[model samples]
Target: MGPYGVETLPPGVVDVPAAPAACRAALVERDRFEWRPADGGDPAALTEEFLLGHGLAVDDLTRPAGHDPAGPCGAALYVSAAAGAAMAGAPSGAANPVATLPEVAVVVYGHARPPRPPRRTEPGRWWVGPWRDSWTPGEHADAVQAVRAAIGRGDVYQVNVVGHAAADYTGDPRPALARLAGLPGARYGGTLHGAGWAIGCASPETLVEVTAGRVVTRPIKGTRPATDAGRRELLASAKERAEHIMIVDLERNDLARLARTGSVRVDELFAVRRWCDLWQAESTVSAQLADGIGLAALLRAVCPGGSVTGAPKRAALELIAAVEPVGRGAGMGALGWVGPGRLDLGLTIRTAAADGDRLHGWAGGGITWDSDPAAEVAEAAAKAAPVRALLAG
Candidate 1:
């Protein structure tokens, strides 16, 4: 609710009927607006009240903020399943599951109408795309240094490390996006092809979603190129299986933390999701939320995603902090929307963005005690391929 006590629509609900199936279509046909990621700042402080803005909205408007339980600041009117869980509920410092999740059904999801693309207003200067200067080229050494530091401090046994590079282009992003979306290994595909902000992603990974009070979280733990006929053989390697199992166990624990006693269970384990370029060992964990526990509260208990964060979440976050730059700028964030007591969301992986001066992209690999630093570095490079392609061309 706004300060004037106006009741806004819950997160993920667009006024258009086509929102559920084709959010971009509904948005393009309606009021044209330029939107970008907010700096997690005070909305009231912004002076330019353009006809529109773009950002996420979370599920369950009723869930109170951790620092202020009585107030309201639902951030976005729509939130992705991941952000919902990440931003929802109070900070759990390890306690009874109920204490951490005061309200169990909080669903995470959000919506963003496409925006007029960002361009250089100055005719002489061209926009090179969003710059992630915080992480620069030849930073593999930096990543390794950070990891070693974390290990030295006992912050984590292993933490996934990411690296970023830029992709610059001057033409319409759709063609580039279409090319990626049509790739051979893409199992999940979507494009928010706005005049300004274009996200063409083909991800075989499903972070989390909920419908009819049922919560589903699918974690893609392993990835290998599909062009290789021996992809299954590669996935069967002990290292890959161990990586997948650790994540599966982490996911199960995450769900079980919020699910009813004996209600949380694994729907599938070590399942394969075949995509255009990659074959993945994905796992599905699900559970029934307690009665009267709205979606907003549910998300608060989990977020930034367990798959990305690794097990022993808080420790993992600290480990990530030691390795990463301060501003993620939507890199590991979640996107999509929530509304009408149901939601659909996807991880913000395989994404590219233009923020002011530079174009940027990122990719990384999960790390375990068994991980090889060189192999992990290669994985990060492999993931960056599409992002670089989008802008390089």
Candidate 2:
């Protein structure tokens, strides 16, 4: 109806096929680009150009993430946005608290796929120290109050408050990290090991997905312990519902910017879903992409996703910069696959990173006018618990 080439269909991961497992991925040379957001450039657009220039369209869906170096061409992709990397304008690309990776990195595998069947890695015994949080409860609560006051002043409707935690570790982190890759209901779950850093994501939220011409974003807002009672509580909580809908509206607008006029729609709203032992509220917003829309334009339109930032994105970023301590490291941005006209990137919420001798993780939630500071703190803990437990093991 709108454009692109994709047929009109319901959006979200429900409509997405299980991502082809990158069982054995070989990092062919990554043609690197150095675009830093701190210098007033767009991280998304840089990655887009890299993706397009590589003739990076994947057609061999049957092949695993990679095949024999000389095997018939097959394609797949994986990208990581370092912490809260934003689009053109507003402030972002804060120093990564632990990892030294670029603010945004979009990688496509080249030749030299596989010379032999990849051997399954047996991670070595590891020890993780007690994690030290970047902010204390009092500090976190104060930031929540700060956001609420900003809302009171009409600066913004809502702002997501995030905090970081890190601990020293020893030995191989790959095994424990592998757990993050298969998290229940994780649309984009996997571990990517780098030179001295590795990222493990168990995120259950979709930042954006484009199939054919339709673009969809699933912004998750509410969180509760997974229980029959929690389900009832999440469904009945006026505050949770309010947070959920605000993001749904924000996403609708995000898609509208790149979509054909009058093509935006909310395909699903406030759907209760499970991620680990927690209950999360999610909604799908979609639109038919405008004609001649390229990857660069798409990333510019939606870089720091709404669910992670807040409504009136620029204003929220300003407030967030002033209040939060430390950077997001490898969390709170995008991670997942990108293809010719299709991509499935997850908002890196429940994600953790291993940088050298330390393991890092981040967690938090949206703050609104009705938020309770203590409750918000506890909720962040609950969201972070699974990742911490996995690392502790």
TM-score of each: 0.66, 0.86
Write model 2 residue lDDT over 254-338, tens digit each, in one string.
7888888999999889999999999999998989888767666776677688888888877887887888788776788777766
Clashes of each: 47, 2
**Global CA lDDT computed for model 2:** 0.70
What CA root-mean-square deviation does each model show from the true structure? 10.7, 8.3
Which residues of candidate 2, in runs, are more than 4 Å off? 1-19, 22-41, 57-86, 110-115
Give me the candidate number with maximum lDDT.
2
Best by TM-score: 2
Residues 347-378, candidate 1, lDDT per residue (tens digit)? Answer: 65675543222344557777765666676776
Write down the RMSD of candidate 2 (Cα, Å). 8.3
lDDT of 2 at 159: 94
